[model samples]
Target: MTKFIIALAYKLETSIKYKRFKEFTYNLLENNSYPYKKHFDTAMIFLVLSTIGILIFEVNHKNLRILNDYELFAVIIFVIEYIGRLWISSDMHKIILDDYEKYQLLNKKYKITKSIKKIISKKVDFILSPMAIVDLLAILPYYRPLRLLRILLIFRLFKILRYANSLKEFLQVFKERKFELFTLGLLYITVVFFSSTVIFLYEGPEGVNPNIVDFFDAVYWSIITISTVGYGDVTPITIEGKLVTLVLVVSSFLVIAFGTSIITTGLSDRMEIIKENRVQSETSKMQDFVIVCGFGMMGRYFCEELLSIGKKFIIIDNDKEIVNSAKSLNYLAIHSDATNMQTLEMMGINKGANSVVALTNDDAVNLSIVLSARAINENIKIISRVNNGNSRKKFDIAGVNQTIIFNDVAAFVASEYLGQPVAFEAIDGILLNKDFDVIIDEVEILDNSKILGKDINLVDFKNYNLTLLGIINLSNMNNFIFNPTNINYTVQKDDILIIIGFKASISQLKSDLINLDFRV
Candidate 1:
């Protein structure tokens, strides 16, 4: 029978359908991004909470037939989840097949007993896990014959931790420092017991400290005194009792101080881990996201603009202080090497990263950033800040989509003010959206547009109070038709129009274009 079972296990191990079934089951239980996992979690949460609430309600109220039926349904669901988790917890077939393969390579007869032990070992490990233990206890209350098990219904609350990530992170801090906490717990227990024994022997109803009636009273007094909550109802009247109380109070302060230090330090480190994990998780779900490779002045301003436009973005910076500052403002910022190809990939380059801006103030870093981003996603747009003029060639060769030379732009702006101050101010005001009520925006021509194939001069830009700056040809973005006034430039699908107008006018024009409502 064991040989036949081993043969069956080996067959299942090579089965694609079996492997897929196991993978899907595991993902349903574990993967946060798995599609039905959310609904499963939500349903389990409702059922768990419902069962717990029903128990609490029945404490004072009578148990109705409807409530019992709901409770039974919830228990059945709990059992299903438990069995599913167990089934996916370990691959018994793989375990048996592995040892069999090892034995086959050795030219020895495979002992199915060894595989059985290994299979049992893994299943036992998972069953004994903390969360698994909680899951087991959660089911205990459903055993109607065991009335005592009903009190374990409170364990249902801990089951929610499986569905909640934040709680897991919060609890993990203590789990990491469990040894220190365990030591502290031992110390406290020893002190409390010793102090309670001393007080009970010295100050009791039979002794001078009469307020302490029994051993229970002595324990109460010891705890209250250690905790610094002396209510004066149970005072240590005797000299020996008072001295013991003094020492206990001092010990309490030390215990409190050490405990706080450990917890505080642990929490600080844990919070950093949690934040990084959160950043990664948030980045994974992002599509067509802009990755800002610095948290400097330019990067901050760019992030602000992106946020204002409701565009999704991820911030990467090597400077921890700058990253923290960004995080303080609730920005999704990660402290990482922007030049690292792995970091770019982690920031969703291989996924749907729309663009990457290398805004670090270093030319070399920005160049490396461009190269790394290009390597990860060749089609992704790479925008870089060129601090040095000589590095422009390197950036160009690295396939940077756009390069911004701050010094050159600033110098040109200064020169432009001298040549065309009024025009400069008007354009700057519209760009800034501060000195004027107008803004510059782009409108893309789609296939269904009413103005498609219409000449530039035919479209009345004055109706929308928009200044037609230029049209970027769909065939080539570099081909911009400047001052396209009364020319035979026909509008076509996918052509982008750069127009300066009010926010409302730009939105209205976009809406009109979408609805094909280009009416005077």
Candidate 2:
């Protein structure tokens, strides 16, 4: 019984360890798993590039012992990464659970052994997958006999294909135009063969010309003439051979031009499609992510605030240059009209979006976006930035939840700065201080929260180093109780708690308030 207990404890420990390991691997490797994935991918890219550089140096400097050592170090890192990935292959726990279920159907005596074998088989299948095969080849150079297989190490560079969206799009272009590319290949080959044969027939020893001796020489001369790389060494002495060369040269140019045009057109179309698909896929995976239409100064500032609060968001703008600028800063942005319903649908505004913020300089454009977003997602919160006060009524009529008037806000801020300089600076210090650890944020109390039915005065916010600034009752919409002295006030579901504290403490409190057992 003691032995059985120890075995059970060991199994529980291993299961916990496996869960942690899987989570870490998923965040490091999977897109949308974490916010810092770009940094991780960039670091891996540099590491791979360094390994490739070392391999190139090793090829030229055979006697350099340090190069060999560097290569070994790279190989060790690759091996560890490969092993970790294999251990946490997709649906690892599911596979084990499936095996356990099958074992339960068998005789009780053979359950443990059969379950073990089944689990091993599933893992072996994962190891034999195409990606796993490449990973194995990447580390095979460690073996003495397979040291020559180090040349295959170059293929390891292709591993980056998984991380690079552009490379994936390039490959997709080729895949989509495979038939056209094949036809082009066949045409080029046929032309080269026919030209080589005809040139040999016209300029061979039996012919009128004696310059070309063999079929290979004729073929070499044909290639040079057609490619416009005339060497003049194996020139056609006969008029017939020269005429044939001219025809081949012209045909080659036509074929080359045709092929180039086809590839260019195909790639352009495929790239656009890939970009759309990528945006759709990323947005679909996100829940409660904000959609910022018009990547102008206001939209940019909103994105900065959202990112500071660790929120996911996508920026949309009709200007390609602005879209590119946002992408340069690692923000997921697309160049497209926000006012169009099709564009809104493509951006997943009707799906997992928490809210839509229209911040275009043009009030008309922002109003159109607000209307379209509300039409698509009736429940989605629509916020519009208005330059004109008259636009606020139109936005409200279109079901916009809020409207920010730039002129009025600017005027208010300026007035406050002039009248209450000290108070303005104090608030600004908390809101804009670069090194300040604390800031004010709002957290909604969900129905399942432990403190939902409790009184505000009973809860010890000071224990968490957080101070309650106010609470906004969503049921009564505009009702806000700021620094309430009422000890009998009870917290209700969907009550927005405006709190000020360190970012970490605020995040923890928010997590506690919305403690729903859910998975991403």
Candidate 3:
């Protein structure tokens, strides 16, 4: 039974792209980027307000025609949003796009179209899954008026929230410690059942609401009280019944506390394992990725830099808590000592990394990573973070690519903050933290844009207050001309301009490019 619960949680989390959907939702909240950002926010707000409004209408004597209408509108919008989410889900190709290419890989050797069809055709179970049943019930069109049953629709939020990393961790822990939870749950049930049976026999005839003529009513009241929810609709009038109720209430609290503790410990352990597995899986598939061996303040800065430039990287750390934290931020991270060769290999360090940044506070651990990496793949670039500036040359002699002394970098940047305002601000915003006013936009030149025929130098970028960081083309996405001196390169259609500027400025630039006159 515990295994079943854990399996369900696993399917909802690791098997689905729930994490990405949360990110997509967050990205949707960004000021500019996607098409449906504003509409999405509007729908969310409407849903919240509508739910509260209708719930009040149901409970109190509030006039609810306007509220009902709004709730209906919100539900309709939510249906559309839900469908869109399903379509955009990672397995969406299987759900809707039934094309041969859907099953075909980049390499033709791994074709599983036949296997996929066979599995889909042979499906037997339909009504067993609670979530599947919930999805079916939510769209059944039977709950037009506000009903208690309709409130179950709120469970749809879990369909989305289950994908979130923190939620996923909770689910994982619940599963890993299901057996203990189940045992405690059984004990709770026994206590409730025994108490209810005794109450029904002892004092049911004397209560005001003696609906406990049968065993079921006694059981229901016991469940309600044990769950710490006394609705006041049912109560005991007899002294014997009231005494039993008091004991049940106190025992319920103790049972709940015990169960919570068990779940917390189970979740912590399972979360660490899940986090490690997630990082390893992601890193295994990544190519030309950077391996960051630590998640300290410095490692976070390094990650933000890579994220700004849209580089692939995985973080490795010995601290399980830090690794889990990184995982929650949607970063791939392994909770293992970076000095270990096995940990490095598991992270695909030997096979796919373009570079490895050893940034753990301990100089010995960082050097060990450099030495181990050198042994595994001498060609792989190693950037070691040095605590003591004097150990820089030793790491250099040990084949480390670059030794960064963080204190010196911080001091230099701090000093420059006074002398060079723009450069310092830009550096601080893009490097130190992710919550900043800067964005990296990759704009493609359309055939109709006026800049297409003009030379890069003559584009009047000075008036626009923008800078061209690099140019990328159809052939290569990574290779870019960074700080190119020559500006005579003619822009063409489909050429990608990797530019960094204030988001508003870039948005205006894109709008201006779209409005440019062209005769073709």
Candidate 4:
């Protein structure tokens, strides 16, 4: 009894370990993370392609030893993968657990034997699943004693469909329109069968027509006429045969048109669903991504800058034309109202979004969007574009983290250019010049950063080829000390450090700061 108990405990502990292993394996196989999962997936893709190539070569050169060796190697890998999947089938454990709970509830007793049986039954069910069966069949060809089983190797190609997003979408389209497609297929078969029978009866051996000597000839002629190919290899020489041919040729166009219409409509609908699914998948995988709540001129400029900097973002616009324009530029865009809470939720603002920018050109709409976004995610950073000076206070009151006054900024630029043309031009050249090697950006200090309690002089910004501009203290939101005279000023938590440097230098500085545990 002690030995049995110890064995059971060990098995349970191993099962728990297997569950964790399954999760890790799933992430490695399915997720798009670089090097780890990506390397595995690439290797698997190469193996699959190699197997297919071997199969093709085997068909042409029947007894190639190299082909057999490659096939054996691929089959071994597939068999190992299949076994790993089965061993980590956590769903089977869930099924067994659920069944055991139900049994205890019904009988008011704990039966180890019954629970074990239930587990075995679930395992059997898993083995018989469609994918599992495919995995098993994919390996059967290696057992060459069954010569007929070699054909089952072709099914290995079907396994690739599991990893293909577009193929899955196509399969979904077919599934959704199966009934319509089935009806059209039936109609086509009926038309072909009836037309062939009538043509054969009218132009067969007893008939006046000599060209169509058999039923198959009449069938072939009907197919050709229906498709409007009109090979003209066989033609009716009698009035009855000609009349039947005319009716079939005319109805064939109608059938073809109807079928085309159904397919076109179904495909359009399925494509839309696929696009939405793709968007959702992308958004789900994103963390710390920006959300641009309009795709106007200002929004477009922001997206362009973000893209140049390699930042991930999604654009939401009410105008379909603007959304399409954004999409044309390869931006992830959704045609929806920026102020709607449901729209923000669908955009995953509460989940993985780092910031939300409202640039709708309407102060009221921007305010609403800011408020809505804050309600959904209190911690999310909110930035809005304010056209009117009066709306700036309203936006601040609505919890907007930042507001850009375009009119004021434009006026200031104009006045600065007029008063000090050379200085203004030099500044503009540095700020607006995309070709400039160095640029300025802000990096926020986190509470846990090593530089938090240290003075500015302690850290060597010059070492990284970065020039210290100033620091904006978050504690006093409006306090920005530019080019501070004091070199011993202590860096505080949540301080935004403004630094200017070359791209590589800035990247190195950012990495160093992040390594020291800076927030942004």
Global lDDT of each candidate: 0.86, 0.79, 0.71, 0.80
Best by TM-score: 1
Least accurate stretch of 10 residues (summed lDDT) in model 3? 92-101
State which candidate has the highest lDDT: 1
lDDT of 2 by residue, 279-396 (tens): 7668877888999998889988999999987899999899989988998899999888888999888777767788999999998899899989988989998889999998788989
Residue 235 Cα positional deviation in candidate 2, in Å, after optimal superposition: 9.6
Model 2: residues with Cα > 4 Å off, grouped in runs: 1-201, 204-258, 261-272, 508-520
lDDT of 4 by residue, 436-487 (tens): 8767888788765677777767667767777889989878865999875365
- Summing lDDT over every window of 10 consecutive residues in candidate 2, give the lowest-scoring window: 511-520
Worst 10 residues of 1 by lDDT: 429-438
- Tens digits of lDDT, candidate 1, 11-65: 8978999899888888889987565776788888898998988988988998899
Off by over 4 Å in 1: 1-28, 33-42, 92-116, 200-221, 229-237, 272-288, 327-332, 336-352, 393-399, 414-422, 452-458, 476-478, 483-486
Give the higher-lDDT candidate: 1 or 2: 1
What root-mean-square deviation over C-alphas does model 4 reach? 6.8
Pairs clashing in candidate 4?
Answer: none
Residue-level lDDT of model 3, residues 146-223, one tens digit each, is 555666656555444323445656776666777887899799989988889878887566544566777788988899
